[model samples]
Target: MISQDVGTRAISVQNVTKQFGFFNALSNISLDVAPGRFVSLLGPSGCGKTTLMRIIAGLDRQSTGRVVIAGKDLSLTPPHRRPVGLVFQRYALFPHMTVSQNVGFALSLQRVEKKKAANRIGELLEMVQLSAFADRPIDQLSGGQAQRVALARALAAGPPVLLLDEPMSALDLKLRQAMQLELRQLQRSIGATFLFVTHDQDEAMVMSDEIVLMNSGTIVQRGSPEEVYRQPRTLFSAKFLGEANIFTGSLRREGNKSLLQSDVVNVRFDVLGARDTGAGLVCVRPESITIEGASKEMFVGTEPNSVAGQVREAIFQGAFRRYLVQVGEQSIMVQQPVLAGTGDAFSQGDQVLLKWSDQAVAQIEDDTNG
Candidate 1:
C-alpha cells in the first residue's frame, strides 16, 4: 500500500511482495527510480535482486501491491507492452540474424518504414562502434562484439528504462573492467534510466549513481557507494559491501567521543545514541589501517587508538604491500602503499604497531545479536 507521488518516477515499486507458496522471495519491497538516472540493484546470489528486476519488467507478478511507470499503473501490463528494454547475461542474439537484423528486430516488429528503420539501425550500430560489423552474422563476432550488438539492440527502441541482469559477467576480467567504464559512459551520453543488477561489488561501485543492496528477500541498505562504504548502518551492510576487520566489544561514551571497549584492544569510535554498556562490534577497513615498525615506547593501555601486533605474513602487491598481523585472537590486515624505493616494507616475524585516526573505524549497529 506504500506509494510515492513526489517527483517524477520512471519506476515506482510499492510494497511489492513475491512468494512461491510459503517461501517469500521478496518481502515488502518498495523502491523509487528517478527518471534518467542509473541505479544498480546489488546483492549476493538468491538475494532477490533478480526477482525484483523481473517484477519491474513485467516478467513476474508480485503477490501483492502495485507498480507504476511514468504516471501509469502498469501492474497488469504485459512484458512486450511495457516501455522497457531488457538485456540478459548471455548475449541472446539470433544465430541466423546479422547484427543489423538483430538491432532492428523491435523496429521491424513495430512495422516502422523500411528506409527509416535502416537509417535508425545504422545510427545505433555507429553508436555502439559496431557499424563495420553490421552486415556480419552473429556467429562471426567476438564475445565483446556480440555484447555490443546486444546492447545496441536493447537501446534501438529508445525505451525510457533499460533493465540489465549481469550483462558483463560472461566477459574476461580485463574486458569486464573495460566494459564497466564504457557502459557508464554510454548511460551518461544516452540519458536513459538504467536499472542494473549484479553481484560484483566493484562493478556496482564503479557505475551506479545509487545502489540498492538487498539481502534475503529484503532491502538491507540503499545509498551512494561512498555513503554505504564509509558509514555502514548495520553489521551485514558493513561485511557484505566490502572487506572488513570486525571487532566484537563493548561501547562507552567519553564527552564528545564514543569508545569501543574490547578484550583485544580499545579504540575511540565516535558512535552516537547507543547504550554506553554492552557487547558491540567495531569495523575497520583494511586500507584505513597504517602499519609501522614498533618503537621502544609502544602504546600502553591508555592509548587512544593504537595496538601492537606481530606480523604473521607480508605479501608484496604491485602498488601496495599487504601485511597480516596477529593481535590476541584477532587477525588484522593493513595495506600500505609502496613508495618509490623506500624499502620500508616489513617482513614475517616483525613486530609492528597498528595506528589509525578515530575517523577511520566505525562502531557498527548489531541488531542480530541476542
Candidate 2:
C-alpha cells in the first residue's frame, strides 16, 4: 500500500486566486499533496491548471492565498530560492551544452565544485537511463531522449518538489505511453513529490495517484482515477473524462428503491438510500450498453430500464463495432466487439434493444445552464 503519511506535506495551496484585470484565472483553489506522491492537475484549455501550477512553482503570484512547500511559507520566496524544479512542455535544454553539462547547469549555478557536479550529473544520467548519451549534444537526441535529459536536469539539485507542465504532449501516441511508464517508475525510485499538469485525461489517469480536475479557474473534482470515473459528480466531468450519454430526468424515491423518470423513458437506478432532489442527470458510458436480439422474447419481461431503438448507422472499428441508434430525435452510441460475423448481424434500420444494469448508471448534478 502507498503511504499516506510521508512525514509531512510536500505542498499546500490555500485560497489561491489569480486574476488579470476583469478576468479571474483561478479562484479559491486549495489542495494538499503528500510528500513523495504523484498528483496531476487535469483540465482543458483556459481552465487555469497552468496558472495554479505556476503559482505553486513561484513563477506566478496569486492574487490572494498562501503557498507552503516543505513546511516553509513561500509567499515571499522567489522562484530561485524555493526547493522546486520545473520542466516545461518543450525540452528547454541548452543547444550548446552536452547532456552532462545541461543536467549539471543548476549545480554549477549554486557554486558546487565542478568535480562534484560532474559526479552528480553522471548519477542522474544513469538514473534516467541516459548515461550513454552524456557526451551527446541536445540537437542529436530524439524527442524522448531530450525529455529524459530535461527530467535529469530538473532533479539535479535534489529538490523536494518537481513540477512537470505537459512534458509529453509533443510525442507520438506509442512514445507517450512508453514515457508515462518510465516517468512513473522514475518517480518511485527517486521518491520525489511530483505535480504534473496535463490536458489529456488518459495521461492523468494512467500516471496520477490522485487527480485534481479543474475548469474555469476552479476545481471541479479531486479523487482517484476509478473514483472520478465511476462517480462523476458533475455533467462536465462525466463528459470530459470520456464519452458519455447523459439523460436529464426527475428522481422518485419509494422506500429503499429509486426510479428516474423522463419524457422518453423511466428507468430504475440503484442509489444508496440517499434522497435525490427534483431534477438530475444520469450518465452512462458507451461500453456499458449491450445490444440484445430483436426477437420480442429476448426482452419479454424486462422492466422500463431497457429501450428499443432502430440502428441508424454501423461502422466496423477493428476491435469493436460502433452503432448509432435513434430514440425519438436523440442519437445514442453503442459499442461492441467485432467478431467474425458480428458486423453482418446488424444493419441500418434494424431494431435492437439497448440494455444496461441500474448499477452502471451514475447520477450527476445537472449544470447545463451554468
Candidate 3:
C-alpha cells in the first residue's frame, strides 16, 4: 500500500487483488490519487499496470478489496455505471461517424439536450484543437487527429476521472512526444484526475505529476519523477528507470560517516542506520559520474570517491557523449555535455579518472525477484 493521500482523493484502490485461476495478475495493490493530478502506472508488460487500470475503471472486478471513486465505492459496478472515461491505444473511433458525431456519441446516448450536446461537442473539439475537423470522417483523420477525437469523445460526458491505456503507443516517436505534452497540458487545464497506464518510461516521466512504478503485481515505488529518478529505493527501481552503475560492498564506519568498501573502488556516504550495515549494494547513475584525463603523477586509488579507468567505448549521442569506462573487472558509464569549445571529450582507449560526490551514491536493496 502506497498512500499518496495529501488531500481529497479522486481515486482510491484499497487492497485490490485480481487473480486469473492459478495466476495472480495483481497482488494486494493499494493506491490513492489526488484530485486533478495526472498519475501514470508505469511498468513493463505483464507487470499488471493495465489490469490495475481496468479494475479501477470497473472493466474488471477485483477478487478482493474495494474500488472507490470520488467518495463512492464501486467495487462491483459495471463500466458504464462508473463515473470514469476510457481511451485506448488504438483510438477506437468510429469510422462511419464524423468527428463531431463521434465526440457527441456519449452525450447523445445520455439524452443531453441537442443544443447543449452540440455546444459541449464544439467546446471539446476546440479543446483538443480539432474544431476544423469536426465534420471529417474518422477514416480521413490522421493518426494524431484520430487520437484527439477519441480524447474529446471521452471528455464529452465530463467524467471526473479518465483512464487511458497507452493512448499514444500507436503514434510515431515525434508525434507521441508531442501528444504527451499536449495531454499533460489538457489534464491541467481541465483539472480532472487522470490515471494513465504505459510501458514507456519516458512517457511516464514526461506526462505524470506522480509516477506509480509497479512490478510483478505490486507497487514498487511512487513519487514525483525527479524523486524517483534521483533516489531509487531498490535495485529494480534504479535499473528500470534509467542506466545504473551498481556496486556491491561492505559498509564500514569512519567517525559519523559510512563508507562502502569494495575491491575495485571505495565510496563515501552519510551514515544510513544500523540496518544498512554489513554486505550491501549501492547504485550510481551515469550522469552523476564526472570524467577527466588521468595525470601520470596522480594516484587515483588514493583519491576519495575516484577510480582510474580506460575508456572502452565512446558513444556520440547528439547533446552529450556516453563513455563506458573500464575499471578493473567492472565497467562504469560516464556522460558529459558536448561543449563546442571545451575540447574535453574523451575517446576510446583514453585513460580517465572517474569521480562523483558522496551524495550521488545511493544505497539500494537488491531485490532481483521483483
* Top candidate when judged by TM-score against the true structure: 3
* Tens digit of per-residue lDDT, candidate 3, span 1-370: 3233523589888899999999999999989898999999999999999999999988888999988888777888999999999999888888889999999999999999999999999899999999899889889988999999999999999999999999999899999999999999999999999999999999999999999999999999999998898888999999999899998889888787778887778888766563347998888999999888985555546755899988999999999999999888899988888888977678889889999998898888888962
Per residue, candidate 2 scores C-alpha lDDT tens digits across 287-343 of: 888986575344322465677778899987889888887766568788888778554
The model with the greater TM-score, 1 or 2, is 1
Tens-place lDDT digits, model 1, residues 1-370:
3244723799998899999999999999999999888899999999999999999999999999788877688898999999899999997999999999999999999999999999999999998889999899999998888989999999988899999999999899999999999899999999999999999999999999999999889998899999888877788888888888887777778887878777778878665564556777878888899887886456434576789888999999899888999887789888888898776789898888898888887777774554
**Comparing 1 and 2 on lDDT, the stronger one:** 1
TM-score of each: 0.95, 0.92, 0.96
Looking at model 1, residue 161 earns an lDDT score of: 94
Model 2 residue 238 distance off true place after TM-score fit, in angstroms: 0.5
| Model 3's TM-score against the true structure | 0.96
Each prediction's whole-model lDDT (CA): 0.87, 0.86, 0.89
Q: What is the lDDT of residue 98 in candidate 2?
A: 95
Error of 1 at 81 (Å): 1.0
Off by over 4 Å in 2: 1-7, 296-302, 338-345
Q: Which 10 consecutive positions of candidate 3 have the poorest summed lDDT?
A: 1-10
Model 1 worst lDDT run, 10 consecutive residues: 1-10
The predicted structure with the larger lDDT, 2 or 3, is 3
